[model samples]
Target: MQKIVDTAKGLEGLKRQWGVHAAGVILSRDPLVDVLPIHKREQDGAIITQWDMGACESIGLLKMDFLGLRNLTILDDCLDAIRENRGEDVVLEQLPLDDKPTYELLARGDTLGVFQFDGGPMRALLRSMIPDNFEDISAVGALYRPGPMGANAHNEYADRKNNRKPVVPIHPELAESLADILGDTYGLIVYQEQVMAIAQKVAGYTLGKADLLRRAMGKKKKEILDKEFQPFSAGMKEQGYTDAAIKTLWDILVPFSDYAFNKAHSAAYGVVSYWTAYLKANYPAEYMSGLLTSVGDDKDKSAVYLAECRRMGIKVLPPDVNESMARFAAVGQDIRFGLAAVRNVGTNVVEAIRRCRKEKGAYTDFYDFLRKVDAVACNKKTIESLIKAGAFDSMGHPRKGLLAIHADAIDSFLDIKRNEAVGQYDLFGDAFGGGDDAVGAGMVVTPQIPAGEWDKGDLLTFEREMLGLYVSDHPLFGVEHVLTAAADMTIGALAEESSVGDGAVVTLAGILSGVQRRITKQGRAWASATLEDLGGAVEVLFFPNTYEIVGQYIAEDAIVVVKGRVDRRDDQPRLMAMDMSLPDITAADEVKPVVLALPRPGARRRWSSGCARC
Candidate 1:
């Protein structure tokens, strides 16, 4: 036992391995090779320093972080889209900070894709705070973390900002001195900058010394804190503050410094949050087009955004080979889905299709499309995927008919190309002649199959399979009334933290998707699935007990009504399903009373006599 303890202690602080920081870089005026050793990472062949950030800083080499944020890219894409579609240039930096519509959108908790303000808890806080200016946005961003949230600082800020609670000072004697520093945060020490400001203002510490004190408090450096305590109290006393006020001010700063965010960082994020909100409120379709293109490869995120689009009264049309670009585009009051977002479609094929469309005219029909598209890029799988995703719907042919003849069309085109490659004569020999004019004339004889359209369920299933979502229609289309009548609330409504309390019982109905069945350690079956309705989707969990009764009904594409309790254990709410059932629109068991009108006073007596005789 003693040897094991000594061995563990010896290994505790030893250098185990070498790794690189994700975004940190060391900047120096001198040559890097002359000052320190460097090497390239094996994965991407990027140069990295031999020492860590702290070592570089200790050696007086300046270290900086260059963060790459996807939201920033989304903002750029949105602005570019606005220019292309609307012919109007939008500069994000020049946007008005006091935009009324932006604040209204934020206050309504409509920030599904807004940066830094999309989470459920953050949205709830925004609704409560009703932020009217940029400062409130910055303060909300700083106060949303674990430290401030744990201390109920977020709720207190909301209440005080909304005039429901009073903004009390840390100490009466120091209130006037600290008011200017803490005024924006409603007398709460929400930022590390505020702590430094307080130290400089009330305790008469120099800027450099106050910054040191802020760092010491944030890192909880006991030695430095103890060393600085005497001077801080003495400075306050010299400023005519009493001992009690000094102690009270110190008490609040100690714990808050642990998680107080930097004001500059929070304000920067607030700028981005406001930009997204502004664009979404004023230019929804254009902004959503860029937003969708940004996350085009992520199916779940695309679905969430599509639901938001629906809520905003913007129609998202399915991918059309004649209309879609490589990325999602915004039409007038609508968004056209991008072809690159299709499951089996590749970028090469998308580029080929676009190039062909731009050079030649629009595809007259499915046959014309096969003839015009690049044979090498648009192969069997690509054509089939495009067909199934409803990309050919605008060519005036049903997806079912296109699916029926797409294989033969591809094979025939390939055969003709093969014959041409071998220097053989044309197969049709001027009957179906070459050149763009002949091709236009040959459209009359294009092959047409007499296949019927698929049912709504099968059509939507194919769309979902190919496009990763049901674009044209959903499975719960006709039965919405039944689901609404059975469900206690929509899945979207349940997503709001204030709409339903944790562990509160509620009923919901939607089509089950992404169902996963698993077995527990005790060999009992459990399952999880995403219940998606018109508004949105929610995760539903079935434990062993509930699974016994509901497992049979839980399957992919099954429309179900789930009775469950809200599970708010995670950032998003989930459903702990207690019972489940299939929606039954045919079931009518209600006993509604029938009323019959009597024309005369004796009509009731005559009807009764007639009923008795019968």
Candidate 2:
């Protein structure tokens, strides 16, 4: 055991693997190959330096990080969509920083898809701060991290910004010098740049030396911090600052340096965050379409954006063969689901559909679509998926009716094409049809079936199966009142950072799906299910004790009310079920009256005598 312990200690700080940085690149005046060891990456054969970023920097080489942000791509797509759909050229760089609508959107906490302010806690902070300008956005980004949040800096910043708390300088002696540096952040030390500026102005340190002090403070090394403080204090005293003021400033710098973010970096993020909010405020459909298209393949992400769209009052129509493109597109004031997002539908099929629509105009009907679509791409499975996904609904056919007749329609269309390939003419072709167009039309007859549609639940299930979500309506639509009356919060609220703390009891009502029962190592049965409300879905766990009582009610598509303690161990919250019951609208609607009667002496005897007389 001693030998093992010694070996583990020796390996604690040793490098275990070599990895390439995601975005970091080393720059050198001389050829990199001549200056440093280099090798080709095994995965892509890209040239890479042997030394890591810190090692390269230590040798006087410049290391630059070129980050590829998805939000930037989303912005580009959104701008193009706005130009194409609305004929508006929206240049993000030229967008006004003080746009009133943008600030209003942030103030309302409707930042579900905005870049930096989209998280629940960040949204709540934005609401509390009621950011009225770009500076507030940057400060919120800097203060939302664990370190600042743990220190309650975000709340303090919010309070200061909203005038709930007064902003005061660190020291009256250095007030004039520090205000210029920290005024934008409501007198809070939010940025590393501010720290450097403070040292330069109040302590009379050179810019380079102040930066060294900033780095030393940021590292939080006792020895380095202790050494850096002597010069800071000496310089402050030389500048006529009192010893007490210097000590007070030093006390703040020591702890705050740990979480102070780079002001420039926060401002850069603020620009992108503002751009997204601006576009969402002005062109919601275009922006949401771009956002949905960016995550079209990811169902969970798509569901989140879809919910956001609903909240924005933008209707996200289901996939329509004529209206939808390969990816999500803005259709007037609404957004249309993309054909490529439908399960079992390939890009090739979506391309074929688009090509056919462009070449032959909008699909007139289901029969016309079958005749004009590329037969090679429009296979039986693809057609069925499109039908189930509501892609063919605009052709005036019920989804169930189309599903019933699609096979025969495809077979009949194929037969006509086969005959045409063989150069065979029907005996009654010319007699029934005068020209090629008429002959083609007369070859395959559209099948007629009952006009009945599937039940709401079945339709939603098919949409979930094919489109990965319910677009026409959600399962919790009609039962919302009942759920609202019983549940403490929605499933989506569980995802918010500020919604509930760990182990806090909460009640939620939603339709249960994906229920799985398993036996624990202790040979006890336990279960897990996804509880989905209108807002979103959350996982609910039923341990052995709870499972024994609620096992009978646990099944797929079961609408149940769950009472549980929130488990926020993961990035998202899950519910540890304490009780579960079916959502009963009748029971929820019943208002039992409380008949209270004051107790009287001999009341029981009087009631018994009255009953005997009766």
Candidate 3:
């Protein structure tokens, strides 16, 4: 208050804010004279003084940031999932930078949790402009933006990577100045470091000055840029560069400066990209688990993650109370769906279930669970959500049975406890001790299924309804072989062979994992068709032509084979189905295994012994 009053009394436009200044305050042998007459408090038999940041800095104290980046947490979670799933502790930091699979992942746009590639548009860009090298990853990280979305940049990038195009030199003299920065990115200014290096090499700018200019360009200050340009041009000519070459290079470099991305930032994110690639290539199950685990409470995200899991052929098992943690967990390679992901199933409820299960064993049946933690963790709505989510199907009941009986089961459970509390215990006198014969123990009063059981399709659909995904199995598992010969490829292999404009006629058979649609700029809706083969998954592009014909077959988890060209648009590749078929599995027949016979050891010896006589 006194400082504020003093600042208010100062000259006009004082601009007083909390500021730190540096000064040396020495302690004398006689402690009283060296110090100012100010309030002092002792701290553990020591004097404590508060100093501001600038004061500390001026006094040569170093500042270190304890930065907790979200990416780091995500990285940790991803690694943890990988470790749990793969049973190997992969040190992501130690991965080789030039991994083929890592580059391949970028090329294919399988960029979920892949550092800077996590955004929808970024994935689309990666798919369209398949990055073939770490430098491509870095360059894309830098080059992709509103301003730097250069004409034919994606094509140029792809061509350069495939060695179909040369790394063009903007200026003959500046070749060495740009070579290292360009690396495999074909002489593009895709990193701020490149700009800095260019400034240093071409115009003799100090690193500090280069950084300042880079910042000025990013700020897009006309006056500052104009002032800086004269020195830059003069420096260029002094180095014996022609005026025309300098001007041309300057035009390219100046525009790039506006969004000249940081190289360190790109490198850091590239590490995450590489880590995800390594996981996808070597430890897919763990990658899927982490991917699914992180999609907290988002059915849409989970749906996408699940589709990726299926695409990767990583099995996502239904949420088993016994196996499931509050969050999604990896049980072997299978992602045990998270209880927290179910609608209305709060974290607290999940914690309660976790605690109850820890105290006891896994709920023997749904009723065993209901008796102990149901009232505490689950309400009618919570139970209903769990039913709809299929968290209880493992309790020896169809999902419909569980869903139908939830109210009666819950009410009956409450009534039984109430009766036992009141004086009605003798009516259900302990047939055995310790309430072992309790009404809801070892048996739950579920509604009866009709005479016939649910068909495979219905069962899968029920699981899908609850899990926000198909977990038990894909709908098209039976037609996997037929689909394979038709498609002539595995999902993992599709991206390996195709060129940017090349297309392959294939028959892809799989269960319809999911369909996501979006409107293009001109208001035309385009859809992405996700299908899961027995081996893995392939994404089909539903162009207006394909969607009009096969859209209905795709909406259900039906067994369908799509005949289409292997589509390459963005660096990513997927099948754009032009034809669809649903094959019948019932018409197929099974055959028995054949066994070979061998002589017994003693008989062989006898035969050998008798051979001379024969």
Q: Which digits, one per residue and each the tens of the lDDT, describe model 3 over residues 224-339?
A: 87988899999999988889878888878777777656878877667666777777666666666666666664555565567677766667777766677767677776668888
Residue 478's lDDT within candidate 2 is 55
Of models 1 and 2, which has the larger TM-score? 2
Per-residue lDDT of candidate 2, residues 430-529 (tens digit):
7755433443466667778559999988888998999878798987665677888788877777777677899999999988888899999999999999
Q: Write the per-residue lDDT of candidate 1 for residues 484-591, one digit (tens) a residue.
A: 889998887787777889999999998998899999999999999999887778899999999998788889999889999899999889999999998785543342
Q: Which runs of model 1 end up more than 4 angstroms from their true locations?
A: 1-9, 221-224, 421-433, 436-446, 478-508, 514-530, 534-547, 563-578, 583-614
- Backbone clashes, candidate 2: 0
After superposing candidate 3, which stretches have Cα over 4 Å from the reference? 1-71, 83-87, 98-100, 118-136, 151-157, 176-185, 221-223, 357-359, 364-374, 377-379, 418-431, 435-614
Cα displacement (angstroms), candidate 2, residue 350, comes to 0.9
Q: Residue 452 in candidate 2 has what lDDT?
A: 95
**Candidate 3 overall lDDT versus native:** 0.66
* Candidate 2 Cα errors over 4 Å, as ranges: 1-13, 418-440, 497-505, 518-524, 565-573, 586-614
